[model samples]
Target: MPTITIKNIPEELYEALKSTAENHHRSINSEVIIRLEQALLPRLKTPKDKLTNIQRLRAQISPNVISADDIDDIINNGRA
Candidate 1:
């Protein structure tokens, strides 16, 4: 396994990581690895991609108006 070394981490971040490690009963090394995974693994979608997805989903669903009476009816009757 390749060893990684990080330097010049801020004191506040270092203290927070230490506290998080203690809270989760993890070693500093394990906590760092988990933090790295959580930080790096999510693929951020672009605004255009998000808008396209919303438009596609909206196209598939029919638009309908829900009146206050309809909402009250559903709340009272437990059915729509």
Candidate 2:
């Protein structure tokens, strides 16, 4: 394993990180690694990915739903 030093961390931020690390049962070093990974990781979602999500959601919905006008009226009424 490699070692890295992070310098000039603000007092408030350091305390928050220390608190979070203790709560998660991780050392400060481990907490920093976990937080860095979460911040750096990129989530890729294509159109196909979105389509699959839409299909899944649609499948769970019942047929013979209310008309668009009815939905619009309901939305407009909510603003009043």
What TM-scores do the predictions have? 0.50, 0.51
Which residue pairs show backbone clashes in model 1?
Answer: none
In candidate 2, which residue pairs clash? none
Tell me the alpha-carbon RMSD of every candidate: 7.9, 4.9
Instruction: Provide the global lDDT of candidate 1 against the true structure.
Output: 0.91
Question: Residue 51 deviation, candidate 2, in Å?
Answer: 11
lDDT by residue for model 2 (1-80), tens: 88888889999999999999999999998999999988898568899999999999999999868988999999999999
Candidate 1 has what TM-score?
Answer: 0.50
Weakest 10 consecutive residues, lDDT, candidate 1?
Answer: 62-71
Model 2 alpha-carbon drift over 4 Å, by segment: 43-80
Error of 1 at 75 (Å): 17
Task: List per-prediction Cα lDDT, in the order shown.
Answer: 0.91, 0.94
Worst window of 10 by summed lDDT in candidate 2? 36-45
